[model samples]
Target: MKNLIAATYAPMHPDGSLNLGMIPSYTTFLQSNSIEGAFVNGSTGDFVSLSTLERKNLIAAWAKDKPKDFFLTNHVGHTNLNEAKELAAHSQGLVDAICVLPPFYFKPKTLESLLFYCAEVAKSAPDTPFYYYHIPVLTGADFNMLDFMKLAVEQVPNFTGIKYSQYNPTDFGKCLHFDQGSKNILFGVDEQLVDSLPLGATGWVGSTYNHLAPLYYKIISSYRNGDIEQAKLLQQKGVFFVQTLDKINGFNGAGKSFMRLFGLDMGPSRYPHKTMTDKQLALALKLMEPQEIAPLFNTSFSVKHLQAIG
Candidate 1:
């Protein structure tokens, strides 16, 4: 079975404060939906908009209540190297793994520079598995992972693999085959999952997994069962799911708000990320109805009951 890690949202209060109280129920929701893991504080979590202290508190809350058999990969990448290291150290004994993104503002001009940044952070958590976040569309440090992995294997003692979010199957394929497939390269593109299937993607981390785990696993099952057309059809529904969220407000905001329909209020997105009103959320759900996507949503957990226990 492929490991499906959901890139979780930073649950907040209506006042834009961290709602650490919501995490226990959040875990229940993911576990009930059959999500295998969580990739916290990554792009979907709005990491850049959060203060360093806030990020620390959020991950700590998650660590305190992690379910048995749940894999937590805390993303500790920051624009500031020292802060990133501090987060890495904080996560050392708390999470199953740690990952870092290249500094985006003064991005690494060469592969060596990026590897050096990863090395410094990896040293902070020497005992934990380390993964380099390769989302060049956001970081602008788009070095080929095939080349990155070659040197990373030789240099970074704890370097494990990458969270590949880009759309380069050729490079991803090569990396998957490198060293006769030792490293754990998790695919990060949700909609392009069907495409990565042929390349041997055994692990995936993405935001849509939060709401669509069953649909995605079905896509994989269909493919492995030699039903290629059914797999493609299901993957198209995944694409439609993203488009529906993107059309209403924006993906980050609307998607977070959409969680409420499943009984988990993710609160509002921070500045620059659009938030939808109750009316807008209704419209988003209605849009999903035509694609038959809305029927597949998970609504097994209750936030209110969880909060009462907490």
Candidate 2:
């Protein structure tokens, strides 16, 4: 959880089967861009649709050539506690960390119950650093993270921190500074990631990091150098990237397909998530070119595309 962790996609063939072959190229692509790690089977990776074996295969493939300094986290969250524990157990000697979002189906009603669920899964893989994926917007377990961590300290032995995907800056800042900076809260919102800099966030786990790590790193440097305007503009480009792709079909599928522009063919997305057409992708690149967010990518496209495309 140190550098930008790309919330990776489950590569697929056009027929909607798992395309495990794309991972090596993907790993090289991320390393080339300084992305540092892969956050597999999370929301971006479409964990819910994957079978237990599929998830395990993904972890194994990505873990094969993982660099010593690279960070690799597998999202082991599932609707079934048993399945979650199974995945956590599966990830035991593989990933650097194992993360779990609250079970969205049955859903935990209270923070304590959610912590109870987390503790159960964490204990399965006692050696792995466990992170609670605090994405309340998706999971409906919208309890306070600071409160969660406080209880976690007393409950879960392997509890590490959170993959906070909410937008509450105050709560986020509080979590980052909690226990005299002992909490390991990785910022999740891409548009407001720069705000986390002053709060001392060195780690982030987000899907957009898959596409915009360079731009984000530049934004961080710009913010540090007092170029607030430049930083704000870059952050806005990130927002623009989301808004644009989201408009085409939906951001998840469209963005997944857009990875082709970077040489990683993630192929088609799974059910309920529309994969982009060639015509659609062409239009997307055309629309994106006007934004001038070139530095956001490793591609030859210039980072100076848009100043106010918003």
Candidate 3:
């Protein structure tokens, strides 16, 4: 499997609509700066708010612009299996893999239900590599890593790996060590890549990677190459940036605003998710400027470039 430093989504317009035009430039920026891949229509993409067609459009647009070697994982998860399956089918030839979070809203009455859901999804995306996305905090379903192992090995034949998003390093480590043969465990916390790497995390999927791709690539590359000190320093800087956003009520508004500052006309976030004020924007710029981090505002690269690098 190709290990990668991947972002979660392309930014959206202020009206909360998909900003298709920004994708090519954004993918180019990722390629020029060493970002290895991206995961679209995931939580960071606000999948919950978008319609199925919109999600398909986003995936199609990305597939068109993304470098062939730049692995793209489409998050086709939905509360309804039919909808999720439809999206998965639509994205079949468009992406490298398909990641689906466990059914949300409805708590599974038994392990069988969860396993059944996985089986269905696996059946739907027969040709696509299917990864189980476990983010218990958001879904209210606490899926133990052991249970997931059983589900993948015995029940879900097409299941290839997981995007473990819970914040517990030990759990992530256990999952990574569980079945290293065919199962891949991608660390989902942006701020914990350095700590997670040593524990056997080969890939990562996170929201902050959208704006911090260059830095993330540097850290992951350093760790993979045995440059521990460099990785640690980069991780420290990442943690600092993450903390800064946390202070401003997390990355919701701050991430979008930072995208705007970088020149993607990604409009403000939708209502219920407030957009940053002038003071907040000032604070964000001040916090990021010293780090010398330039957002990929208008760069363009093709999937061919990514394939060549690979």
Question: 190, model 3: CA deviation in Å?
Answer: 1.0
TM-score of each: 0.95, 0.94, 0.85
Model 2 — which ten-residue stretch has the worst lDDT?
Answer: 301-310
Native-referenced Cα lDDT, model 1? 0.89
Best by lDDT: 1
Clashes of 3: 8
| Top candidate (TM-score) | 1
lDDT for position 17 in model 3: 74
Better of 2 and 3 by TM-score: 2
Q: Candidate 2: how many backbone clashes?
A: 7
TM-score of 3: 0.85
The better-scoring model by TM-score among 1 and 3 is 1
Local accuracy by lDDT, each model: 0.89, 0.85, 0.74
lDDT tens digits, residue span 1-310, model 1? 1478899999999999999999998998998888988899999999999999998999999999998699988999998899999999999889999999999999999998988999999999999999999999999998989999999998899988899999899999999899999999999899999999999999999999998888998899999999999999999999998998898788988878778766788898998898788777667666777788755666563445334333
Q: Given candidate 2, what's the lDDT at residue 35?
A: 87
What alpha-carbon RMSD in Å does predicted model 1 have with respect to the real structure? 3.5
